[model samples]
Target: MGTLKNQVQLIGHVGQEPQVTVLENGKKVAKISLATNENYRDSKGEKQTNTDWHQLVAWGKIASLIEEYVFTGKEIAVQGKLTSRSYEDKEGVKRYVTEVIVSEILFLGGNGK
Candidate 1:
């Protein structure tokens, strides 16, 4: 078998305020949007920035940390595994989502700005 992994690491600014929810089992889950981007000059020498948004999910203690510390424009580094799943929406339409299931997080230069 080939040596393979499903890990991901990223450093970016929080795209929005995390939405924290509590399950019936009293477990906490937080969903956060992260913005990662790069700036470069195009072929015409025009400076431009391209940003990609990522979906991040944190659980338990990490979820609490996100609720208390993470905010829009906050910068943070995260290590996690990429996950994808599908579910049916209220309209009975299937929806697919990709997300980083965050395991560890570190505050970057801008905790919040």
Candidate 2:
């Protein structure tokens, strides 16, 4: 391709602890929910905060690191790309979802502990 695209960056708090699953091929995948907050003043001169939740997936070394030090409420910055897929449910219903596949994760706040 002439130019690169499909990149995303997010700085947010970990909504929950990473859930790790081992694939049949022995590769581990970690899934977590991240919450990004937006703050602004409303029309009535009141502050409002809005939170958006994002799905994040990490594999291999990143997964390992997430399991080691990451936790619920921890702030992190991630560089990744957005991905979406569809799958059939048990009732033959199609379910669609989107996620961010993180390549790099930086721990933030409180000396990154």
| Count of clashes, each model | 0, 0
Query: What tens digits encode model 1's per-residue C-alpha lDDT throughout 1-113?
Result: 36458989999999989999999999999999999999999999999999999999999999999999889889999999999999999999999999999999998875444
lDDT of 2 by residue, 1-113 (tens): 65568888999999988999889999989999999999999999999999999999999999999988899999999999999999999999999999999999999985545
Let me know the TM-score candidate 1 reaches against the reference structure: 0.90
Model 1 spans > 4 angstroms off: 1-4, 110-113
- Model 2 weakest lDDT span, ten residues long: 104-113
Using all chains and alpha carbons, the TM-scores for the candidates as numbered come to 0.90, 0.91
